[model samples]
Target: MSMIEVHHLPPGTRAGRARAWEELYATQVERATVTLGESETGPTLSSGTLGPIRLVRIEMDSGLLQRTAEEIGHVAEPAYSFLLQIAGQASFSHYGQDCVLGPGDMSLCNNAVPYSYTAHGPVELLLIRAGIGTIREHLPSPEQFCGRHLRAAEGLAEHAVGLSQSVFFQLAADLPEAVHNRVARNLLDALATAFAIGFDDLISSSAVLTGRHARVRLFIEENLRNPDLSPGFIATRLKVSSRYLRMIFAAGNETASAYVLRRRLEECARQMADPACAHLTITDIAFGWGFNSAPHFARSFRERFGEAPRVYRREKLAALATGGGALSAGATESV
Candidate 1:
């Protein structure tokens, strides 16, 4: 099953609702100052994790939210948030740009910097937060696009918004982990495409490189179970020189070997924490995810997860049994 969380202020006094709004933003979204504009009704929030991505659905009355530079220091992991306005009207200010969004409008915001959002009235929003590294390869300079509202009724942007909304609504706590991860990846890809529509010339100029990079990533994902996966092997399979392959990955602030190792370790960790894999031995799980040596896998797993694989799996399973759901046993290290 996947992990999901729901929070609500209920029908309460204005003060109580304001308190709930503050807590919800601090914990679920990011550190921010939330002011209730109406102060008549409370807010409701439902959020869940889909692999590396986080989806949040918020329904609230008029409010003004601000995340100052001082608050950004409190964020341990920086991410990019894509918001789809489901109803009402709102304006966002970030990256020296201020834009108003109506229903069916989408906008991107970076959590690393200060931002402000003001809702004109009651609003409903569906937001997707993804690791910066996950989308950086596609949109090299996301700041330029941040705060620029895109009409969801036009072109690829519309399809992308629809895809994200459908996935968010259909996600369930009991869905297969693989399905959840795949859907997350798909949504990211769709968003990348949607964001690129605003910069057609830029995308056209880099189409070849972007296409190749995507192909390489797809190849790596498809063959993660191959113990012999390496930069040389991957380069050979893609018919590219090893040096060129390294250059491509380097441009994205990653090395081919490091990328392969990270993916393998991530796969092993996912399987280790999966409930269905409880019957498998730790060593078996490691090898199944392409690790050739148990000792090496254990060492790498500990380095990545801050604990041994066995310990992580046990703790995560225990947490699940107690209904204390977590996306991972430990916070994921930056890519």
Candidate 2:
């Protein structure tokens, strides 16, 4: 959570300054070519890394950043850039959609796809990067939210932007690992809400089914600590057929059971990483999160995070103690 600052270029020739700017953009963001405007000042970037998420704040004169098809091929895995406009304006284009982003507005872009951003005069933005796995854990179909304007200054979108900005600029650098994980979770939840609102037309067209799906998810979240929270139990409690419950989850390419297991595991991981929960044994945390069988939780946790739960907790705690971040094990499909 420690911020690293990249200030203006050192006194040098114009060509040298341009090269320096290009290298900084490539490293801080994605592999892209930067076209600087007619100005002597270079952009200022402040960046921080929290686990799998990377946050960056950029302030610069008008310029263009282009990611070509070849650059897309070079990416090792799918990821996303959630951009929040802090000052001035910027335009973004990706996957055949284009939109202008003004202050207090936000948008998401796929890093594995060809995209470009052009700044109008001076602009400032906070960009949050997460692997596709992390994005999918929060947003079912993340791609649908890409390149669309998510306005702040009112409603849920405003809260999401404010949280993002606060995390980027105000997080105490020494927060516990659990706090960092929770902050990331809450931010993503807010973004998911805003993204859903961005799809008003789709929700309106399928209002009944969408309403049912929302109810199902809310029920699951509220009862996650209940070991009996199964698909059959959920269907019965919500007055929906098991077949219909499956159908609702199918729309998101996930099974109701899978979602439950994923969430439970996430909760267990959060507790395990928390120092306040250090009094609780790993098995206690698992059981509290509705994981009944120790062996089953072990296997599933390994598969999901690419490590045993105890090992993950140990490494996470150790990293936090030393003021460093640890990467999550696996990634999921693109948005």
Model 2 C-alpha lDDT per residue in residues 1-335, reported as the tens digit of each score: 44455556665776787788778877777777676766788678777776678888888888777775557667777788788888898888754457898888888888765567889999998888889889878876666566667777545777788888877765545546667777777777787777777677756656667667755765676677789999999999988899999988887788999999987886677657654456677788888878889889999999999998878887776655435543233311110
The global C-alpha lDDT for each of the candidates, from Candidate 1 onward, is: 0.75, 0.75
Per-residue error (Å), model 1, residue 173 = 6.9
Candidate 1 Cα outliers beyond 4 Å, as residue runs: 1-3, 10-12, 201-335
Q: On residues 64-100, what C-alpha lDDT tens digit does candidate 1 reach at each position? A: 7778655877988989899888889998875444688
How far out, in Å, is residue 225 in model 2? 50
For every model in order, what is the number of clashing pairs? 0, 2
Residue pair clashes in candidate 1: none
